[model samples]
Target: MIPPEVPLDDEELVTRAQAGDLEAYELLVARHTASAYRTAILLGAGADAEDMVQEAFVKGYRKLSRYRGDASFRSWLLAIVANETRNLHRSRDRRTGLVLRAARAAPYSEAAEDGAVDAALAGERRATLVQALRSLPERDREVIVCRYFLDLSEDETVAMLGWARGTVKSRTSRALVKLRGLLDVEELSRG
Candidate 1:
């Protein structure tokens, strides 16, 4: 189900977008721009990421007529973002490194802490987590990002990743295990 607070209904927005309503398209963009930006940034090609997002948005807007509405617009848009990000990396001929960077690093949260010690520790932890993520294989990293950070359900994740149900089940399990192992290392390092 679409989140109740999503500001507008998917069907209504799609209908409006189809009818050449520019504001309706803007509303869709407003609703998803953050996720698209974060996904691009996390993919670790800032310029490429921005370009990919813009391209994806344009493509998505053009293809609005084909939207089946089986998945919410957000999910469908995210799929495009993910695919475009992958394609951009491929075009640059740097898939492996970019994928690792995306998997290993996370966006630093500016508002996490204000106190000196807390802030320092949070920064360190964030960096450590990113390093650990960078160390994992691409499949593991992709799973972690889609499942945890993006807060997608199993079904949504399957759709976004274009993986089968069984693949998602097993891959999510493997990714969590790898992430935990990395976090454990962090704990040990801290102690």
Candidate 2:
């Protein structure tokens, strides 16, 4: 049995999965699950992220026959996860709020060097940014999250959002401007 970490390329796993190799499919899921969850979370799926990721994997498995070899398997799987997250968002009527998990602090020595005041300031800044992000329209938020938070390439964003490349670029530019405005307003209100 080949070890899961043997670095079999996604294309190979996908081919095996297409041949009804369950372990190959499982490996694909294991590889992409974290990223899928993060994308769901950034899209505001909240507690439903886990379910969304699971559903995406199941759906992806069922639809493996339709998956062309053109796109990377991870991108294709993520597009399905994005769609699942969007569907859940629509059905739930956007009930859950966005939760921004704070970054883990550095080692104790490094954290001590940074000091309590700096950490508090950083936390407050992060909170403000999260609030601003939550205030944007869902479409804008989705573009911003895909482009920035998820760090997806333009092509990947296009695939995930089912938008044209030009559309992705335009939306990302517009969303950034809107986000900046929101953050500015927040700063002004604080002052």
Q: 1-191 in candidate 1: lDDT tens per residue? A: 76678566767988899899989998888878888877766655565777878888999998998988877777788888888887876777754433334534554466555677777777777777777877788777777778877788887878778889899999889888888998898889789
Runs of candidate 2 with Cα error greater than 4 angstroms are: 1-6, 95-113
Q: Which pairs clash in model 2?
A: none
**CA lDDT, candidate 2, residue 61:** 95
Q: Candidate 2, residues 26-58: lDDT per residue as tens digits?
A: 989889998988877776667778998899999
lDDT of each: 0.77, 0.80
Error of 2 at 118 (Å): 2.0
Pick out the ten consecutive residues of candidate 2 with the lowest summed lDDT.
101-110
Q: Evaluate model 2: give its lDDT.
A: 0.80
TM-score for each of the candidates:
0.81, 0.86
How displaced is residue 189 in candidate 1, in Å?
5.5
How many residue pairs of model 2 clash at the backbone? 0
